[model samples]
Target: MPTTNQYEGIKHIARITTNFEDTCEHCKEHFIDPATATNHYIKEHGYKILYIGPESDISGMEHYHWTVTILGK
Candidate 1:
């Protein structure tokens, strides 16, 4: 889960402690803190959903930056 930054700027904050492999499958990077990592994900990969903009996903839209809420919704 996000664990941090649940709604900071558009994020749905969730915390994660297990399933490191799964997280890797989704995003191939790690951060010491939620603020840095989430911010990086948003800036590096995120895209405005429809110009009107609501949800944001990973960098590649379908690959690098996945938008799945598998846990801790």
Candidate 2:
């Protein structure tokens, strides 16, 4: 699927669900893509990357990062 600059790192994640089942913690918006979720926090709000989900050692890149966009600026 096509992604915007906000969610370009979707592919870089080790384990991210492509299903838009996930909901935003702040806006409570549903998205089928993880990138969309990340972008939502970054664009809609003003959150920074506190930490990228730790990389998976067993699977190699299955880990993802959390967008603290809602928690803080």
Candidate 3:
């Protein structure tokens, strides 16, 4: 069986979901892909990566990052 623990090292997270889910505040257009939208996000959307991932879900690489994107976005 797999175990789930609440306490972990990557608890810090920046809630940048609204931006990924919705359009840019100024232009008003949808994000192509929230998971790999860093380029689009930073360039077209003018978003800064204030936080460098290591988000709460320490389950795995894709799982951790994607969970935030799907649920949050």
Candidate 4:
């Protein structure tokens, strides 16, 4: 289900993890931390929704996949 950002009033829920090797889908750059990826998405891409997979997904060393969607047009 799509959830809203309580702080920014955006429409989407962001799932952050300790997975440090994640990358930004927009910029196609690897991030050492999820928060940095999130900030880049918001400050640069203006994205509202960032859905990250479960911990097991990252722990398994699977390919990182983030589904991004912009909210409020």
Candidate 5:
């Protein structure tokens, strides 16, 4: 068992894009898709996806992006 404080400083946000250049703010890794980026945080970093933000347009890039909030112990 772990206390709430154990998870402090372990929450992070990952930005995933549909243009095959996804980025994870915690690990600083790039992925090709949202699934890969999410899985990387879960599997490799032992983090759980807490929230998936709504898709947002990337201005003139013509592609959309979203944020994935994750937390770990």
Candidate 6:
């Protein structure tokens, strides 16, 4: 079985937002929606979407933002 440590450094992440300007963490490109940001990482950055959920840091605020965590190749 694969160990957790083996995957420790293989994760990449990006942030998508509805209220603020969304920037692609990997390529510094701007996206309008979460889907576009997510697709950018997958198709252009060679990353697979592992999890997408509300960013805990900004949770419970008025704005809606999502953190897209991906597995890198």
Regions of candidate 3 where Cα sits further than 4 Å from its true position: 1-15, 18-20, 52-73
Worst 10-residue lDDT window for candidate 6 reads 64-73
Clashes of 6: 0
Q: After superposition, how far is residue 1 of candidate 6 from its true place, in Å?
A: 9.2
Candidate 5 achieves a global lDDT of 0.62
Question: In lDDT terms, which candidate is top?
Answer: 5
- Kindly report which residue pairs in candidate 6 clash with one another: none
Candidate 2 per-residue lDDT, tens place, 1-73, comes to 9756655434322223442257766677877777777677678766555444433233475754343222234
> Could you give me the TM-score of model 4 versus the true structure?
0.42
Deviation of model 6 at 34, angstroms: 1.1
Selected candidate, larger lDDT, 1 vs 6 = 6
Local distance difference test, candidate 4: 0.55
Q: Which lDDT tens digits does candidate 5 get at residues 1-73?
A: 8657544575454444454576677667767777777678788877765555665676686776655444453
User: In candidate 2, how many Å is residue 71 off?
Assistant: 7.6
Error (Å) of candidate 1 at residue 48 is 7.0
Indicate the worst ten consecutive residues by lDDT in candidate 2.
11-20
Q: What's the true lDDT of residue 31 in model 6?
A: 77
Q: How would the candidate models be sorted by lDDT, starting from the highest?
A: 5, 6, 4, 2, 3, 1
lDDT of 6 at 41: 72
Worst 10 residues of 3 by lDDT: 64-73
Superposition TM-score, candidate 5 onto the true structure: 0.47
Q: Write the per-residue lDDT of candidate 3 for residues 1-73, one digit (tens) a residue.
A: 9886433343333244422364444465556555544445566544545443334445555443332332111
For each candidate, what TM-score against the reference? 0.29, 0.43, 0.34, 0.42, 0.47, 0.51
Residue 67, candidate 6: C-alpha displacement in angstroms: 7.6
